[model samples]
Target: MVSFKEIKNDLPAGIVVFLVAVPLCLGIAMASGAPLFSGIIAGFVGGIVVTLISGSQLGVSGPAAGLAVIVLHAIEGLGSYEVFLSAVVLAGAFQLALGFLKAGSIGYYFPSSVIKGMLSGIGVIIILKQIPHAFGYDESYEGSLHFMEPDGKTTFSLLFDAIRYVSPAAVIISGLSLAILIFWEQILSKKGKIFQIIQGPLVVVILGIVLNLLFLNVYPEMALSANHLVELPVADSLGGFFQQFTAPDFSRVLTYEVLFLAGTLAIVASLETLLCLEATDKLDPYKRISPANRELKAQGVGNIVSGLLGGLPVTQVIVRSSANIQSGGRTKLSALIHGVLILGSVIAIPGLLNMIPLASLAAILIVVGYKLAKPALFKSMYRGGWNQFLPFVVTVLAIVFTDLLTGIGIGMVVGIFFILKNSYHVSHTMLTEKTPAGKEKYRMVLAEEVTFLNKGNIMQTLRKIPANAELEIDMSRSAVVDPDVRELIEDYKNTARSNNIKLSIKETAEDEKLEYEGMKF
Candidate 1:
């Protein structure tokens, strides 16, 4: 259950999140090649519907940038966007089943180091992805998360194009917007509550619109073109606005392609949502723990509503969630209010929103990205030592060079390797002594839980045990031993007599017998 406290903080935070979310929603829809209304619908459901169902106070759900490519290809393969909506509906049902089945525990397995890496990696990508837009290059769709694009343009190439064909008007607006955001956040904001209440992102957007309008009237040549400004589909009447929403094509709902794609959507959307949920909780200042199962259920319902309403799949989104936290949101009210603000704006002030420049939004995201990938964060991670640092750096690199999911998978593999290495290298302890007659004696104390991963280290220790010695294998503390490890010890025991060594096995009392794979030893 969410509390209703902190209206002062959450109100401003909600406004900030709403400002940041609008452009992203449109950009993601554009990137997916879907109707512009689809992104807005997903964002709406994620905020209004998901927030009501989710246990997380800070997590913000919406159409995700990570899903842009998958959605793009799926729409193409399904022959029509309406047909794809059926798959999304099925995917939502699948996620709902997963939630009820308690599969949300999968989120607990993500290592902290890898999670931090994902955050930093995404931060870097956000900045890189927004750079071209800041310079007025709109060829690469907004919310494009991958390095490679459908148009055969890489992130760097687009950046180069931005530099080569720079728009002076965009640069001026983005630069000034960046300055104001920094000024408000750094200097003026510390002065009074008014600064925090007004919020820099809102101020930036308004100033951005006003500046562009001034340019249009005074310096006509310097004004941004329609391509550079927001391009939401305008409607003449309330009925026309309602007409924008498309219902799913249920006739093809049972097709194999639809089912397969539905499964794909369920798995990918759920994975992304779980990952974002984990990251959001970690970022929460109060350190509140959210119920993962409940979050999955919320996301499930959000996607179902989104699909039925002709929107994209919904997931908990890190970028908007981080914005909420950074903006000082304290409860789920911020998310709910942001959804309400989204609704109000679309109905009353979309024309005002359409006047805002994309460059100003880019500046806001750049600032958010900078905070997420601060140099100090890297320094702190490096101080955590190689086990943590290696995975962190690898994840950042993989995200920048590859894509989000693949990068996370690569980072997880690296983190798991170090875990196994620790198990293999230090799975036991050995104590050396001398018997009364001066014959060497050795006691190898096994770890509480020894698996096949420790086989090599245990075997090496046995091979080095000298002849004419007394060796004791201690299993008193061991709870479970893998068959491979137990068998290796048994083989060493068999050869002890030939080596002129006496061997003894120390097990726990009969009441607490040593546990071996599938049996008691």
Candidate 2:
């Protein structure tokens, strides 16, 4: 059972998480072509609704960055943003089916190296993506997807634009906020338990807002624009509350294009959620296992809520989960409280939040990215084995050059390569026997599930077997053999006549061949 001590310990962390999430929720929504309010809705559902059903104690769910590309394309293809909400609802239904079918186990098949690489790759991307925004260079929106200028300008061109066009107020606020966040960790944490207990990110957010307000009032001309802060839909009364709900254009959802978009969202969202869940569990402080199937169900529920309320699809996010762990979270209550805090802040203190600078949020993400790409992470994987390193590197490179799915697919291939490479090394054996009668003997055995890769080993073993011997072959426990292995065995049998060996099968049957044929490749 979860303890109150854990809950109490998590309060400070929850507050920090809420602060970090607020801007991100809005930024991701903005990037996805959805209304800013939709991001808040997703954050709320992820924190409150998803946490209730999730098996993970620390993982926090929200609108995922990985879905940005898909969401962007979907919105454009669907003609209207409201029409895409129907796809979101259908995607949630698909995820629910995946949970019931216990498909979450698929996450376990990913190699540790590949997962680590993916995380690191994503970390680098986050840092790169946020560089412009952190400096208060708000060009082409906060979360721009296209590497090249949307209008054919290069990345260097965009950087030039930012340098020339950045607002003085935004630069000052961002610089100051980043400075405070940096110093807060170094100075405050050394003071006492209470100071250390409070997260640096939270301190930065609070200070950023205060600074914004002070700057705005004192020097209105030099102040950052209203766009810098989170834009929440503040509702003062009952009627205003109901107006927030965004209804779906269900009439257009049955179109072929809509159906394809729904399928894409369902598959990608489920995959990314499961991936985050798996990675987060590995990073858990207590080394506990989370129920992936349950996570899927919870995420499905969250997506449904988000879809109905004009929010994007939700997924378990590693950034917030790691922050939850780092911030001393002991239970899922931290996540629940964060959700409450999000709703309360938007309703009661949006004016206060509006003071926060985008750079401050970028500072938090930079730190998160560093944690995922820590030097020790690579060292640890190397010490574990090369089997892990190859896939991990492949995943990282693939993600950096391509996208999430492409990177993961490449990593999987590298992982399979290692698996087969390892298998071939220990999978076959040939023995030579000596008898008083001067009749040489040989024994050959092939491992179960032998593939073509194992042929070299099998042939090498066969070549060492003595001639003029009574040969005994073992296939009793072997399940399946590749065509290469069959060819090797048949070749050996044919050559036995010249070798003067009496070949005998220790175990063989017609049924065995049929069973082997039925086995998976």
lDDT tens digits by residue: candidate 1, 322-414: 999998899999999888887778877888888989899899899999988999989999999999999999988998888889899999999
Q: What are the models' TM-scores?
A: 0.96, 0.86
Model 1 clash pairs are none
lDDT of 2: 0.77
Say which candidate scores most in TM-score.
1
Give one digit per residue, the lDDT tens place, for model 2 in 55-171.
888899988867877887789977798899999988898888899999899899887788888888777666666666666776545444234333566444666776777776666
Task: Give the candidate number with the greatest lDDT.
Answer: 1
| TM-score, cand. 2 | 0.86
Question: Candidate 2, clashing residue pairs?
Answer: 113-392, 440-469
